[model samples]
Target: MSLLLETLTTGDRITFICTGLLGLGVLALLSRPKVVAAEDGVTVTNLTTTRRLDWAQIVRVNLRSGDAWVHLDLSDGTSLPAMGIQPGIARDRAIADARALRALVEAHGTGHSAT
Candidate 1:
Protein backbone atom coordinates (compact mmCIF):
# COMPACT_ATOMS: atom_id res chain seq x y z
CA MET A 1 0.00 0.00 0.00
CA SER A 2 2.84 2.44 0.87
CA LEU A 3 4.62 1.68 -2.44
CA LEU A 4 1.38 2.30 -4.33
CA LEU A 5 0.94 5.64 -2.57
CA GLU A 6 4.52 6.62 -3.39
CA THR A 7 4.03 5.77 -7.04
CA LEU A 8 0.89 7.91 -7.15
CA THR A 9 2.67 10.84 -5.53
CA THR A 10 5.55 10.61 -8.00
CA GLY A 11 3.15 10.67 -10.88
CA ASP A 12 1.43 13.69 -9.42
CA ARG A 13 4.75 15.50 -9.08
CA ILE A 14 5.61 14.78 -12.68
CA THR A 15 2.22 16.06 -13.78
CA PHE A 16 2.65 19.23 -11.75
CA ILE A 17 6.09 19.92 -13.26
CA CYS A 18 4.90 19.33 -16.77
CA THR A 19 1.89 21.55 -16.25
CA GLY A 20 4.05 24.36 -14.95
CA LEU A 21 6.39 24.04 -17.94
CA LEU A 22 3.54 24.17 -20.37
CA GLY A 23 2.07 27.21 -18.71
CA LEU A 24 5.42 29.01 -18.92
CA GLY A 25 5.69 28.20 -22.61
CA VAL A 26 2.26 29.61 -23.24
CA LEU A 27 3.13 32.74 -21.32
CA ALA A 28 6.23 33.23 -23.40
CA LEU A 29 4.28 32.92 -26.59
CA LEU A 30 1.65 35.34 -25.38
CA SER A 31 4.29 37.91 -24.43
CA ARG A 32 5.78 38.09 -27.93
CA PRO A 33 5.86 41.60 -29.39
CA LYS A 34 3.34 42.85 -31.89
CA VAL A 35 4.57 44.91 -34.85
CA VAL A 36 2.30 47.34 -36.60
CA ALA A 37 2.60 50.16 -39.11
CA ALA A 38 0.28 53.09 -38.78
CA GLU A 39 -0.40 55.99 -41.09
CA ASP A 40 1.84 58.23 -39.03
CA GLY A 41 4.50 55.88 -37.74
CA VAL A 42 5.73 52.35 -37.13
CA THR A 43 5.53 50.42 -33.90
CA VAL A 44 7.43 47.30 -32.94
CA THR A 45 7.01 45.35 -29.76
CA ASN A 46 8.61 42.13 -28.64
CA LEU A 47 9.61 40.31 -25.49
CA THR A 48 12.97 42.09 -25.36
CA THR A 49 12.61 45.09 -27.67
CA THR A 50 10.18 47.87 -28.38
CA ARG A 51 10.69 50.63 -30.95
CA ARG A 52 8.60 53.30 -32.58
CA LEU A 53 9.46 55.65 -35.42
CA ASP A 54 7.65 58.53 -37.00
CA TRP A 55 7.39 59.18 -40.75
CA ALA A 56 9.64 62.22 -40.57
CA GLN A 57 12.50 60.20 -39.12
CA ILE A 58 12.59 57.76 -42.00
CA VAL A 59 15.57 58.36 -44.32
CA ARG A 60 15.25 56.11 -47.34
CA VAL A 61 13.80 52.83 -48.58
CA ASN A 62 15.67 50.43 -50.83
CA LEU A 63 14.34 47.36 -52.56
CA ARG A 64 17.37 45.38 -53.58
CA SER A 65 17.27 42.10 -55.48
CA GLY A 66 14.44 40.48 -53.57
CA ASP A 67 14.88 42.18 -50.21
CA ALA A 68 13.51 45.47 -48.99
CA TRP A 69 15.95 47.54 -46.95
CA VAL A 70 15.18 50.72 -45.09
CA HIS A 71 17.79 53.38 -44.54
CA LEU A 72 17.40 55.89 -41.75
CA ASP A 73 19.25 59.02 -42.76
CA LEU A 74 20.82 61.09 -40.05
CA SER A 75 22.25 64.58 -39.96
CA ASP A 76 25.75 63.11 -40.24
CA GLY A 77 24.97 61.08 -43.37
CA THR A 78 24.53 57.87 -41.39
CA SER A 79 21.40 55.73 -41.30
CA LEU A 80 19.76 53.16 -39.05
CA PRO A 81 17.60 50.31 -40.30
CA ALA A 82 14.33 49.89 -38.55
CA MET A 83 12.80 46.53 -37.77
CA GLY A 84 9.56 44.97 -39.15
CA ILE A 85 11.02 44.45 -42.61
CA GLN A 86 10.02 41.41 -44.66
CA PRO A 87 12.57 39.73 -46.85
CA GLY A 88 12.04 38.98 -50.58
CA ILE A 89 9.20 39.64 -52.98
CA ALA A 90 9.09 43.38 -52.53
CA ARG A 91 7.74 44.27 -55.96
CA ASP A 92 5.15 46.96 -56.48
CA ARG A 93 4.45 48.03 -52.93
CA ALA A 94 8.12 48.06 -52.05
CA ILE A 95 8.96 50.21 -55.03
CA ALA A 96 6.24 52.63 -54.15
CA ASP A 97 7.39 52.82 -50.58
CA ALA A 98 10.97 53.26 -51.77
CA ARG A 99 10.00 56.21 -53.87
CA ALA A 100 8.18 57.81 -51.03
CA LEU A 101 11.14 57.12 -48.78
CA ARG A 102 13.49 58.70 -51.28
CA ALA A 103 11.43 61.81 -51.39
CA LEU A 104 11.54 62.02 -47.65
CA VAL A 105 15.31 61.50 -47.60
CA GLU A 106 15.85 64.20 -50.18
CA ALA A 107 13.89 66.55 -48.06
CA HIS A 108 16.06 65.64 -45.09
CA GLY A 109 19.32 66.44 -46.96
CA THR A 110 20.37 63.02 -48.34
CA GLY A 111 22.59 61.69 -45.55
CA HIS A 112 21.48 58.27 -44.38
CA SER A 113 22.52 55.04 -42.75
CA ALA A 114 21.79 51.73 -44.44
CA THR A 115 20.91 48.46 -42.81
Candidate 2:
Protein backbone atom coordinates (compact mmCIF):
# COMPACT_ATOMS: atom_id res chain seq x y z
CA MET A 1 0.00 0.00 0.00
CA SER A 2 2.82 2.42 0.84
CA LEU A 3 4.61 1.58 -2.41
CA LEU A 4 1.44 2.19 -4.41
CA LEU A 5 0.85 5.54 -2.67
CA GLU A 6 4.43 6.65 -3.35
CA THR A 7 4.12 5.90 -7.11
CA LEU A 8 1.26 8.32 -7.78
CA THR A 9 1.95 11.76 -9.34
CA THR A 10 0.73 14.91 -7.54
CA GLY A 11 -2.14 15.32 -10.02
CA ASP A 12 -3.16 11.70 -9.67
CA ARG A 13 -3.16 11.98 -5.90
CA ILE A 14 -5.28 15.12 -6.05
CA THR A 15 -7.76 13.44 -8.37
CA PHE A 16 -7.96 10.39 -6.15
CA ILE A 17 -8.54 12.50 -3.05
CA CYS A 18 -11.22 14.58 -4.73
CA THR A 19 -13.04 11.49 -5.95
CA GLY A 20 -12.95 9.94 -2.49
CA LEU A 21 -14.27 13.11 -0.89
CA LEU A 22 -17.09 13.35 -3.43
CA GLY A 23 -18.05 9.74 -2.79
CA LEU A 24 -18.16 10.38 0.93
CA GLY A 25 -20.36 13.44 0.41
CA VAL A 26 -22.81 11.42 -1.63
CA LEU A 27 -22.87 8.70 1.00
CA ALA A 28 -23.53 11.21 3.75
CA LEU A 29 -26.46 12.75 1.86
CA LEU A 30 -27.92 9.36 1.03
CA SER A 31 -27.72 8.26 4.66
CA ARG A 32 -29.41 11.34 6.07
CA PRO A 33 -32.64 10.06 7.66
CA LYS A 34 -35.63 7.85 6.96
CA VAL A 35 -38.90 6.44 8.22
CA VAL A 36 -40.19 2.88 8.15
CA ALA A 37 -43.66 1.50 8.72
CA ALA A 38 -44.14 -1.87 10.36
CA GLU A 39 -47.18 -3.93 11.15
CA ASP A 40 -47.88 -2.13 14.40
CA GLY A 41 -46.00 1.13 14.17
CA VAL A 42 -43.58 3.43 12.40
CA THR A 43 -39.93 4.12 13.03
CA VAL A 44 -38.12 7.37 12.30
CA THR A 45 -34.38 7.11 12.03
CA ASN A 46 -32.40 10.34 11.71
CA LEU A 47 -28.74 11.18 11.72
CA THR A 48 -28.64 11.26 15.52
CA THR A 49 -31.68 9.37 16.81
CA THR A 50 -34.13 6.62 16.10
CA ARG A 51 -37.70 6.81 17.39
CA ARG A 52 -40.47 4.24 17.28
CA LEU A 53 -44.10 5.15 17.70
CA ASP A 54 -47.02 2.80 17.92
CA TRP A 55 -49.97 3.42 15.64
CA ALA A 56 -52.20 4.33 18.52
CA GLN A 57 -49.89 7.07 19.61
CA ILE A 58 -50.08 8.87 16.27
CA VAL A 59 -52.94 11.28 15.75
CA ARG A 60 -52.30 12.29 12.16
CA VAL A 61 -49.77 12.54 9.35
CA ASN A 62 -49.31 15.88 7.68
CA LEU A 63 -47.52 16.78 4.45
CA ARG A 64 -48.42 20.31 3.68
CA SER A 65 -47.29 22.21 0.61
CA GLY A 66 -43.86 23.87 0.88
CA ASP A 67 -42.89 21.51 3.66
CA ALA A 68 -39.72 19.54 3.24
CA TRP A 69 -41.08 16.25 4.49
CA VAL A 70 -43.99 14.53 6.20
CA HIS A 71 -44.75 15.37 9.80
CA LEU A 72 -46.44 13.14 12.32
CA ASP A 73 -48.72 14.59 14.92
CA LEU A 74 -48.76 12.48 18.02
CA SER A 75 -51.47 12.15 20.62
CA ASP A 76 -49.02 13.37 23.20
CA GLY A 77 -49.11 16.91 21.83
CA THR A 78 -45.82 16.61 20.00
CA SER A 79 -44.87 16.06 16.41
CA LEU A 80 -42.22 14.03 14.70
CA PRO A 81 -40.60 14.56 11.31
CA ALA A 82 -40.73 11.75 8.79
CA MET A 83 -37.59 12.24 6.79
CA GLY A 84 -38.28 9.35 4.45
CA ILE A 85 -40.89 11.36 2.58
CA GLN A 86 -38.70 14.21 1.50
CA PRO A 87 -39.61 16.68 -1.23
CA GLY A 88 -37.37 17.80 -4.11
CA ILE A 89 -36.59 16.07 -7.38
CA ALA A 90 -39.35 13.51 -6.76
CA ARG A 91 -42.11 15.72 -5.47
CA ASP A 92 -44.96 13.65 -6.85
CA ARG A 93 -43.58 10.45 -5.46
CA ALA A 94 -43.07 12.05 -2.09
CA ILE A 95 -46.65 13.31 -2.11
CA ALA A 96 -47.91 9.86 -2.93
CA ASP A 97 -45.89 8.37 -0.12
CA ALA A 98 -47.26 10.95 2.29
CA ARG A 99 -50.78 10.03 1.25
CA ALA A 100 -50.13 6.36 1.78
CA LEU A 101 -48.67 7.07 5.20
CA ARG A 102 -51.72 9.12 6.09
CA ALA A 103 -53.91 6.24 5.12
CA LEU A 104 -51.94 3.90 7.30
CA VAL A 105 -52.24 6.20 10.25
CA GLU A 106 -55.95 6.56 9.71
CA ALA A 107 -56.51 2.86 9.33
CA HIS A 108 -54.55 1.80 12.40
CA GLY A 109 -54.26 4.86 14.62
CA THR A 110 -57.86 5.56 15.49
CA GLY A 111 -59.85 4.92 18.64
CA HIS A 112 -56.85 3.94 20.74
CA SER A 113 -55.25 5.68 23.67
CA ALA A 114 -51.63 6.70 23.84
CA THR A 115 -50.99 4.58 26.92
Candidate 3:
Protein backbone atom coordinates (compact mmCIF):
# COMPACT_ATOMS: atom_id res chain seq x y z
CA MET A 1 0.00 0.00 0.00
CA SER A 2 2.83 2.41 0.89
CA LEU A 3 4.56 1.61 -2.43
CA LEU A 4 1.39 2.55 -4.34
CA LEU A 5 1.11 5.81 -2.36
CA GLU A 6 4.73 6.69 -3.20
CA THR A 7 4.14 6.10 -6.88
CA LEU A 8 1.06 8.32 -6.86
CA THR A 9 2.96 11.09 -5.08
CA THR A 10 5.77 10.94 -7.65
CA GLY A 11 3.31 11.12 -10.49
CA ASP A 12 1.58 14.10 -8.96
CA ARG A 13 4.87 15.91 -8.52
CA ILE A 14 5.84 15.37 -12.14
CA THR A 15 2.47 16.56 -13.36
CA PHE A 16 2.69 19.69 -11.25
CA ILE A 17 6.20 20.48 -12.57
CA CYS A 18 5.09 20.12 -16.18
CA THR A 19 2.05 22.31 -15.60
CA GLY A 20 4.19 25.08 -14.11
CA LEU A 21 6.59 25.07 -17.07
CA LEU A 22 3.73 25.26 -19.54
CA GLY A 23 2.22 28.22 -17.71
CA LEU A 24 5.54 30.09 -17.78
CA GLY A 25 5.91 29.53 -21.52
CA VAL A 26 2.46 30.97 -22.15
CA LEU A 27 3.28 34.05 -20.12
CA ALA A 28 6.45 34.63 -22.13
CA LEU A 29 4.57 34.54 -25.43
CA LEU A 30 1.86 36.92 -24.26
CA SER A 31 4.52 39.32 -23.01
CA ARG A 32 6.13 39.66 -26.44
CA PRO A 33 6.65 43.14 -27.92
CA LYS A 34 4.01 44.50 -30.33
CA VAL A 35 4.01 47.61 -32.55
CA VAL A 36 1.15 49.65 -34.02
CA ALA A 37 1.02 52.47 -36.54
CA ALA A 38 -1.51 55.17 -35.78
CA GLU A 39 -2.64 58.39 -37.47
CA ASP A 40 -0.02 60.56 -35.79
CA GLY A 41 2.85 58.08 -35.77
CA VAL A 42 3.91 54.58 -34.76
CA THR A 43 3.70 52.95 -31.38
CA VAL A 44 5.67 50.04 -29.90
CA THR A 45 4.34 48.26 -26.89
CA ASN A 46 4.86 45.17 -24.83
CA LEU A 47 3.55 43.43 -21.73
CA THR A 48 5.07 46.17 -19.58
CA THR A 49 4.32 49.43 -21.52
CA THR A 50 4.04 51.38 -24.83
CA ARG A 51 6.11 53.72 -27.07
CA ARG A 52 5.21 56.33 -29.70
CA LEU A 53 6.94 57.77 -32.81
CA ASP A 54 5.82 60.70 -34.98
CA TRP A 55 5.37 60.24 -38.75
CA ALA A 56 7.90 62.90 -39.74
CA GLN A 57 10.69 60.82 -38.28
CA ILE A 58 9.88 57.87 -40.49
CA VAL A 59 12.34 57.00 -43.30
CA ARG A 60 10.95 53.92 -44.99
CA VAL A 61 8.79 50.86 -44.49
CA ASN A 62 9.78 47.27 -45.24
CA LEU A 63 7.59 44.27 -45.97
CA ARG A 64 9.32 41.08 -45.07
CA SER A 65 8.63 37.47 -46.15
CA GLY A 66 7.27 36.14 -42.85
CA ASP A 67 3.73 36.45 -41.52
CA ALA A 68 4.43 38.51 -38.43
CA TRP A 69 6.26 41.69 -39.37
CA VAL A 70 5.56 45.31 -40.55
CA HIS A 71 8.74 47.28 -40.06
CA LEU A 72 9.14 51.07 -40.24
CA ASP A 73 12.38 52.80 -41.13
CA LEU A 74 13.37 55.90 -39.22
CA SER A 75 15.14 58.94 -40.60
CA ASP A 76 18.27 58.23 -38.61
CA GLY A 77 18.83 55.04 -40.65
CA THR A 78 17.37 52.76 -37.98
CA SER A 79 14.69 50.16 -38.65
CA LEU A 80 11.89 49.49 -36.19
CA PRO A 81 10.20 46.12 -36.42
CA ALA A 82 6.45 46.26 -35.81
CA MET A 83 3.92 43.66 -34.71
CA GLY A 84 0.12 43.02 -34.90
CA ILE A 85 0.52 42.80 -38.70
CA GLN A 86 1.02 39.33 -40.13
CA PRO A 87 0.21 39.79 -43.81
CA GLY A 88 2.17 36.79 -45.01
CA ILE A 89 -0.16 34.51 -43.09
CA ALA A 90 -3.15 36.11 -44.81
CA ARG A 91 -2.24 37.02 -48.39
CA ASP A 92 -5.17 39.35 -49.07
CA ARG A 93 -4.72 41.57 -46.05
CA ALA A 94 -0.91 41.58 -46.26
CA ILE A 95 -0.81 42.95 -49.77
CA ALA A 96 -3.41 45.59 -49.03
CA ASP A 97 -1.66 46.83 -45.91
CA ALA A 98 1.71 46.91 -47.70
CA ARG A 99 0.23 49.02 -50.48
CA ALA A 100 -1.28 51.49 -48.05
CA LEU A 101 1.96 51.88 -46.13
CA ARG A 102 3.90 52.39 -49.36
CA ALA A 103 1.56 55.14 -50.39
CA LEU A 104 1.84 56.86 -47.05
CA VAL A 105 5.64 56.75 -47.14
CA GLU A 106 5.75 58.16 -50.62
CA ALA A 107 3.28 60.89 -49.75
CA HIS A 108 5.51 61.98 -46.89
CA GLY A 109 8.22 62.73 -49.49
CA THR A 110 10.97 60.39 -48.26
CA GLY A 111 12.13 59.96 -51.91
CA HIS A 112 12.93 56.26 -51.40
CA SER A 113 12.47 53.87 -54.34
CA ALA A 114 9.77 51.23 -54.01
CA THR A 115 11.46 48.25 -55.59
Candidate 4:
Protein backbone atom coordinates (compact mmCIF):
# COMPACT_ATOMS: atom_id res chain seq x y z
CA MET A 1 0.00 0.00 0.00
CA SER A 2 2.84 2.38 0.83
CA LEU A 3 4.58 1.62 -2.44
CA LEU A 4 1.34 2.23 -4.40
CA LEU A 5 0.74 5.52 -2.61
CA GLU A 6 4.31 6.65 -3.26
CA THR A 7 3.92 5.94 -6.97
CA LEU A 8 0.90 8.22 -7.29
CA THR A 9 1.45 11.97 -7.83
CA THR A 10 -0.53 14.54 -5.83
CA GLY A 11 -2.84 15.16 -8.77
CA ASP A 12 -3.36 11.43 -9.22
CA ARG A 13 -4.18 11.01 -5.53
CA ILE A 14 -6.72 13.83 -5.62
CA THR A 15 -8.29 12.42 -8.75
CA PHE A 16 -8.54 8.96 -7.20
CA ILE A 17 -10.15 10.31 -4.05
CA CYS A 18 -12.63 12.44 -6.00
CA THR A 19 -13.53 9.48 -8.18
CA GLY A 20 -14.15 7.31 -5.17
CA LEU A 21 -16.36 9.95 -3.61
CA LEU A 22 -18.33 10.35 -6.81
CA GLY A 23 -18.87 6.61 -6.99
CA LEU A 24 -20.14 6.54 -3.42
CA GLY A 25 -22.55 9.41 -4.12
CA VAL A 26 -23.91 7.64 -7.13
CA LEU A 27 -24.41 4.43 -5.16
CA ALA A 28 -26.21 6.29 -2.39
CA LEU A 29 -28.51 8.00 -4.84
CA LEU A 30 -29.31 4.72 -6.51
CA SER A 31 -30.01 3.02 -3.21
CA ARG A 32 -32.24 5.79 -1.87
CA PRO A 33 -35.77 4.74 -0.96
CA LYS A 34 -38.73 5.25 -3.30
CA VAL A 35 -42.52 5.22 -3.03
CA VAL A 36 -45.03 4.60 -5.78
CA ALA A 37 -48.79 4.85 -5.63
CA ALA A 38 -50.83 2.91 -8.10
CA GLU A 39 -54.50 2.28 -8.67
CA ASP A 40 -54.40 -0.75 -6.46
CA GLY A 41 -51.99 0.29 -3.72
CA VAL A 42 -48.82 2.02 -2.68
CA THR A 43 -45.38 0.44 -2.98
CA VAL A 44 -42.47 1.53 -0.82
CA THR A 45 -38.97 0.35 -1.63
CA ASN A 46 -36.29 1.05 0.92
CA LEU A 47 -32.74 -0.23 1.23
CA THR A 48 -33.58 -3.48 3.00
CA THR A 49 -37.31 -3.86 2.54
CA THR A 50 -40.12 -3.45 0.02
CA ARG A 51 -43.69 -3.09 1.23
CA ARG A 52 -46.98 -2.86 -0.59
CA LEU A 53 -50.15 -1.60 1.05
CA ASP A 54 -53.58 -1.64 -0.44
CA TRP A 55 -55.62 1.57 -0.52
CA ALA A 56 -57.77 0.36 2.34
CA GLN A 57 -54.76 -0.38 4.50
CA ILE A 58 -53.42 3.15 4.44
CA VAL A 59 -55.17 5.24 7.06
CA ARG A 60 -53.59 8.56 6.27
CA VAL A 61 -51.02 10.47 4.20
CA ASN A 62 -49.24 13.41 5.69
CA LEU A 63 -46.44 15.83 4.88
CA ARG A 64 -46.07 17.97 7.92
CA SER A 65 -43.88 21.07 8.10
CA GLY A 66 -40.16 20.38 8.51
CA ASP A 67 -40.60 16.73 7.64
CA ALA A 68 -37.97 15.36 5.31
CA TRP A 69 -40.55 13.45 3.33
CA VAL A 70 -44.16 12.36 3.20
CA HIS A 71 -45.33 9.71 5.66
CA LEU A 72 -48.09 7.20 5.38
CA ASP A 73 -50.09 6.09 8.39
CA LEU A 74 -51.16 2.51 7.96
CA SER A 75 -54.03 0.51 9.34
CA ASP A 76 -51.55 -1.81 11.04
CA GLY A 77 -50.51 0.91 13.49
CA THR A 78 -47.29 1.79 11.72
CA SER A 79 -46.06 4.69 9.63
CA LEU A 80 -43.93 4.44 6.53
CA PRO A 81 -41.69 7.14 5.15
CA ALA A 82 -42.15 8.04 1.53
CA MET A 83 -38.91 9.18 0.02
CA GLY A 84 -40.44 10.09 -3.29
CA ILE A 85 -41.85 13.31 -1.88
CA GLN A 86 -38.66 14.79 -0.54
CA PRO A 87 -38.71 18.19 1.19
CA GLY A 88 -35.58 19.78 -0.20
CA ILE A 89 -34.42 21.22 -3.51
CA ALA A 90 -37.75 21.04 -5.37
CA ARG A 91 -39.92 21.69 -2.35
CA ASP A 92 -42.86 23.10 -4.25
CA ARG A 93 -42.92 20.10 -6.53
CA ALA A 94 -42.64 17.78 -3.57
CA ILE A 95 -45.55 19.45 -1.88
CA ALA A 96 -47.59 19.19 -5.03
CA ASP A 97 -46.76 15.54 -5.33
CA ALA A 98 -47.71 14.93 -1.73
CA ARG A 99 -51.02 16.66 -2.29
CA ALA A 100 -51.63 14.53 -5.33
CA LEU A 101 -50.90 11.41 -3.32
CA ARG A 102 -53.32 12.52 -0.65
CA ALA A 103 -55.94 13.13 -3.27
CA LEU A 104 -55.44 9.62 -4.58
CA VAL A 105 -55.89 8.15 -1.14
CA GLU A 106 -59.03 10.16 -0.59
CA ALA A 107 -60.51 9.13 -3.91
CA HIS A 108 -59.62 5.44 -3.86
CA GLY A 109 -59.17 4.49 -0.23
CA THR A 110 -62.27 3.60 1.73
CA GLY A 111 -62.79 5.98 4.68
CA HIS A 112 -59.11 6.96 4.79
CA SER A 113 -57.92 10.26 6.21
CA ALA A 114 -55.30 12.48 4.58
CA THR A 115 -53.55 15.70 5.40
Per TM-score, the best of the predicted structures is: 4
TM-score of the candidate numbered 3?
0.58
Q: Give the TM-scores of the predictions, in the order they appear.
A: 0.38, 0.71, 0.58, 0.73
The sequence of per-residue lDDT tens digits that candidate 2 reaches over residues 59-106 is: 878878888877888888998887878877489888888777777877
Off by over 4 Å in 1: 1-31, 61-115
Candidate 2: Cα lDDT at 63: 78
lDDT of 4 by residue, 5-114 (tens): 89999999999999999999878876777888898998988766788889888878888888988889988899988876787858899888888888888888863655
Q: Candidate 3, clashing residue pairs?
A: none
Ranking by lDDT: 4, 2, 3, 1
RMSD (CA, Å), candidate 1 to true, equals 6.9
Q: How many clashing residue pairs are found in candidate 3?
A: 0
The collision pairs in model 4 are none
Q: Which candidate is the best by lDDT?
A: 4
**Model 1 lDDT at residue 15:** 92
Question: Which residue pairs collide, candidate 2?
Answer: none
> What is residue 100's positional error in candidate 3, in angstroms?
2.1
Global lDDT scores for all candidate models: 0.54, 0.81, 0.66, 0.83
lDDT string, candidate 1, 5-112, tens digits: 677776797898999999999888656644455666655555566767565555555445645444445444555543334343345655565565555455543334
Q: With candidate 3 superimposed using the best TM-score fit, by how many Å does residue 83's alpha carbon deviate from the native?
A: 2.7
